[model samples]
Target: MAERRMMLRDPGLQPERTRLAWSRTAFSLTLFGLLCFRGWCRDGNLFYGVSALISGVALTAMLAGWHQRHGKQFLSLSLWSVGALLLLNSLRQVLA
Candidate 1:
């Protein structure tokens, strides 16, 4: 009988790719936040300002503790919250 062995590391650079993807996402969120701030400055919309603040805080938290066990959970929640905020803002703009 032959015993199977588990590999300690991924051979396909999955971890590196994942890290890069996350970095890109963080960069995108930063850009989105900046755009929101710009919108607030131009139109004085409180929602834009609040969205920018939330984006900044979420990005900070995600980056600060990404290696922790609960980091993914936090990331998921942050993404959903940001998405929801954007959706609500879009709906408001359309309705107004």
Candidate 2:
């Protein structure tokens, strides 16, 4: 079977902070994606708009998952997702 990647345990620990951080990252990605897409798509259909939409979906997915779970795996998933977005941003900057 595929390895399980997310968790949803209370763990009796503070989840609010973790959840808030994830929410912040998600919001940032949504904002960045929009900004980049707008800049890249100034002309009729410059493009990158599709990527902005995808990032929005990713942000929603991360928020939904994090809000419902607070475990190591959940944290890991959020971290990886945020990291991926950062990496993509770096790539865009370098490639541009």
Candidate 3:
């Protein structure tokens, strides 16, 4: 009898690339939210500050989900929430 080692095959690189893309998107969104926060602090507009804060939190959750290879539902929900918050932020500006 001979001892043998079993190795798992590589699943290719596409998943890694997708994960990286998601991380980059989250990073960019976080930066944009920070800019909004700074503007809100300067001008005293609660809308910008609130929206940015919510978006930042959602983006952080999304990043965590992606990093952990969590279910798509969590990531999707966070992504959509971020988009909605950003939309509200823009509409508030236009309406003002």
Candidate 4:
């Protein structure tokens, strides 16, 4: 009888890459939120304030799920929330 050998699959650095990507997204959201807050403070506009609040909430959600092994759902929802807020804000600006 002949012996059969099995090969193992390597995951490589995909996990690390994913973590780094998330970190970059978090950093971008933080910067955007800060800018929105600054705009609100300077112009006293409700839209800017609301946008800032949404960004903060999204960022918080991202951070809350950062250490979890299965946090993709949380991150996805947060990103979608931010996208929706941005779209609404853009439409408001265009209409006004």
Cα lDDT tens digits for candidate 3, 4-95: 33454467887998878877877787887888789789988776677677767767777567546663566566557666766887798799
Q: Please name the candidate that would achieve the greatest lDDT relative to the true structure.
A: 1
40, model 1: CA deviation in Å? 1.2
Count clashes in each candidate, considering only residues at least 3 apart in sequence or on different chains.
Answer: 0, 0, 0, 0
lDDT of 4 by residue, 10-60 (tens): 578878887898899889989988998998999887767877887787788
> Clashing pairs in model 1?
none
Clashes of 3: 0
Model 3, TM vs. native: 0.60
Candidate 1 Cα deviation (angstroms), residue 80: 2.0
**lDDT value for model 1:** 0.80
**If both were scored by lDDT, which would come out higher, candidate 3 or candidate 4?**
4
Question: For residues 1-96, could you state the per-residue lDDT of candidate 2 as single tens digits?
Answer: 234534555665667776677678777877867775785578333235545555665666676774455444654565466456556766876899
Q: Could you tell me the lDDT of residue 83 within candidate 3?
A: 68
Candidate 1's residue-wise lDDT over 1-96, tens digit each?
Answer: 133345365678987898898889889989988998998899988878888888887788768865355677776776677678778988999999
TM-score of each: 0.74, 0.46, 0.60, 0.67
Candidate numbers sorted by TM-score from highest down: 1, 4, 3, 2
